[model samples]
Target: MSDIFNQVDNSIYSNAMTFLRVPLVMDPIAAEADIAVLGLPFDIATSGRSGARMGPTAIRQASINLAWEGKHFPWKFNLLKKSKVIDAGDLVYSTGDAAEFTQKVEKAATQLLASGKTLVSLGGDHFVTLPLLRAHHQKFGEMALIHFDAHTDTYDNGSAYDHGTMFYHAPNEGLIDPQKSVQIGIRTVFNEANHGFNVIDAPQANDMSVEQISTLIKEKVQGMPVYVTFDIDCLDPAFAPGTGTPVCGGLSTDKILKILRTLTDINIVGMDVVEVAPAYDNSEITALAAATIALELMHLWTVQNKQV
Candidate 1:
């Protein structure tokens, strides 16, 4: 009808103002935001694999195609869209010192939390979650964790800030309470015999069904503020082959989504997705999975906050 509306391609371009269409800010204005995503690209010290340092960029590139369905998201419940989420880029890390890197991550996370915004973190490794959680605990204190992974990640502080020890190390730091924490999709083989951390593995419980695990998560995290962390290696390599440490017998992408979706009632204060190494991914499937989970977490946060 009008030249301004001339032959638009809705199939390729839906909305210009959606989150995916905006320019990714390296240093976004922190104070006036609803949700802030900061990347921590320092997985160099990871004992499992070192490629996770590239995870943030891969997830960012994969997120460019994210769409806004407004209220009717086909993947999950129609989450309210009142939330404002933005990428705040990666924090600087020291290659030499683990403690220094942890401090830097804590600083960035603290700044974002002070803004009263939810932190959707793109991680360097699972170890980065420790620093992020350290900041959240500073403000909230003793939040429950909904950890998704193949291994327990509770290895005693072996040497330094590596991927295998964040869960164990956090509790020792009083950042996470092991009794209140809930871990899902935990497969064996990476246990005490394999030099892994000591965590209560729910997937090993009776019948090991998604419903069973979901119920356990609900029961464990009830009435407690929650932090949800997703490790790409948590999924079987068939679904997420790009992680630095690809583990077998892990949860499927669909299974992980189902568990997270059912936990919508918990107060999800912060979130992180890590260990996605694009270098090993031939089909870009791992990045896609990570990006999709990020959007799902955003939806859950938005719905809970009534932002949609």
Candidate 2:
């Protein structure tokens, strides 16, 4: 058989693969033998730029270049030695069908969740989060969300699904309890009609220190399960220029990284890094940033899973 696992850095602990790492795994069951990964490349309906469909590919390619650190964290957990992470590949979908794609995501994610395997999700856009949350809610009811973005993604336009209207549909479906959730690093403009979906606004976020923000989340999200959905637009366009939407005067990259690293004890069941549009990117910096955050998510999984 082919090599089961390979090391990105020889000195780092080895992270295993089941058999082979394909480009994108269309079928979650057939493609995912052990650990599964699925991509949701659905960015056609974005209100901002129209190229976030390339997010999954760009993230995968950038990940290939990252050197895995041997030590999981300073705490001495070794994820590379213990965890068996596989590349299940991206999900398959037809062009120009949002509802169909949502159903497809729900079916595939349900299987993956039932199998008791961790799925590392790469996004097509922010809208994908709603369907993923729907699938997970069916498995683990009423999960808390830790959303990081420039906009509070809770808007129900009384229409179909799209990037801007995802969070609004979540509570209506009973998937998310806005009161139990916390939104960080948000900065943008919105209308008065989009209210009632509880979220910590960015104007308030901007005034507080990072420590204060982290402390607030710790207090608010205490004793509940959380899913982290990071939209690349949460960071300033100067820091991440390659997203479907680029909001100005947002969180800096280093500041966001510090925040993720500080939440050492939050129970992050699953995470998704989204809205990375490569078509607008010149240096490919945004993809690399998203991939790095994915690594941080892996670290969070290792740290939290071991504690359990």
Candidate 3:
């Protein structure tokens, strides 16, 4: 049955489930692919809703809707053909244990990075990026961050496991250089006096053209290895209502795509799409948006690697 399916194009509803129908390899270190997709399916750190733990499954299922397209539009080449990508399934850990989850994620990510493969993770919440960042920092010292979210995730008042304080921990741990990092689509109130990251709030981002925004991002992270983390709440609630903490004023799906398309020249080393909670979603729009964004990130990676 598997061999027969391999001989034909997978229908949108058929075949083994993976991101963009990519092969599934459980062991990341042993996977012989240039890109490895890992799912972080734990969301205990959210201060609002709890369903983002299901984000990986929803995003992968929604990605099948995009698999039918041989070549994603606005780009001239086929992504899978240009790059060897595989879904490494989800990271397993003790249920509801945040410490175990973080340790496992960092260890797995570290192993994957050491084995010479780039990682694109699917998050349970924004906090997942913290562990991934730790792994990336070990591999590529002091990288710049390109963050997309309505909240800055830089609060100093939250607990160690809070999703709202990853950035606060990131900078203090030296995982990312705040001066070189750029946070886009932030609409929440944060302490500007001590916020070292170059922030382009929602209103500011909306006023600027995609060219201007992309240029600013490139300028901020130009000379450093970059890691991009996108939270679904970065989009306006109308565009992505399936997130735990949806903000009213946020960037549109189209605008975010345009900005990502313009960032092909940067040294992006790793990336993740987080905070997609399908329970609040209408017609799977949020998951689809995330899937599309993840696909665009892959294209961007391909461009940086000169695969296209």
User: Which candidate leads the pack in lDDT?
Assistant: 3
TM-score of each: 0.85, 0.85, 0.97
- Model 1 residue 303 distance off true place after TM-score fit, in angstroms: 1.9
CA deviation > 4 Å runs, candidate 3: 1-9
Question: What TM-score should be assigned to candidate 1?
Answer: 0.85
The digit string of per-residue lDDT tens for model 3 on 1-308 reads: 68855586567776637899888887769878889999999889999988999999999999999988889998999988889899999999998899999999999999999998999999899999999999999989999999999999999898889999999999999999999999999999999998899999999999999999999999899989999999999999999999999989899999999999999999999999999999999999999999999999999999999657
Checking candidate 2 for backbone clashes, the offending pairs are: 25-89, 25-90, 39-90, 154-168, 155-168
Put the candidates in TM-score order, highest first. Answer: 3, 2, 1
Listed per candidate, the RMSD to the true structure in angstroms reads 4.2, 4.3, 1.3
lDDT score for candidate 3 against the true structure:
0.93
Candidate 2 lDDT for residue 197 = 40
On TM-score, the leading prediction is 3
Order by lDDT, highest first: 3, 1, 2
Give per-residue CA lDDT, model 2, range 18-63, as digits (tens): 1112333445565434345567788865887888888988877666
* Candidate 1 clash pair list: 80-308, 81-307, 81-308, 82-307, 82-308, 83-307, 154-197, 155-197
How many clashing residue pairs, candidate 1?
8
TM-score-superior candidate, 2 or 3: 3
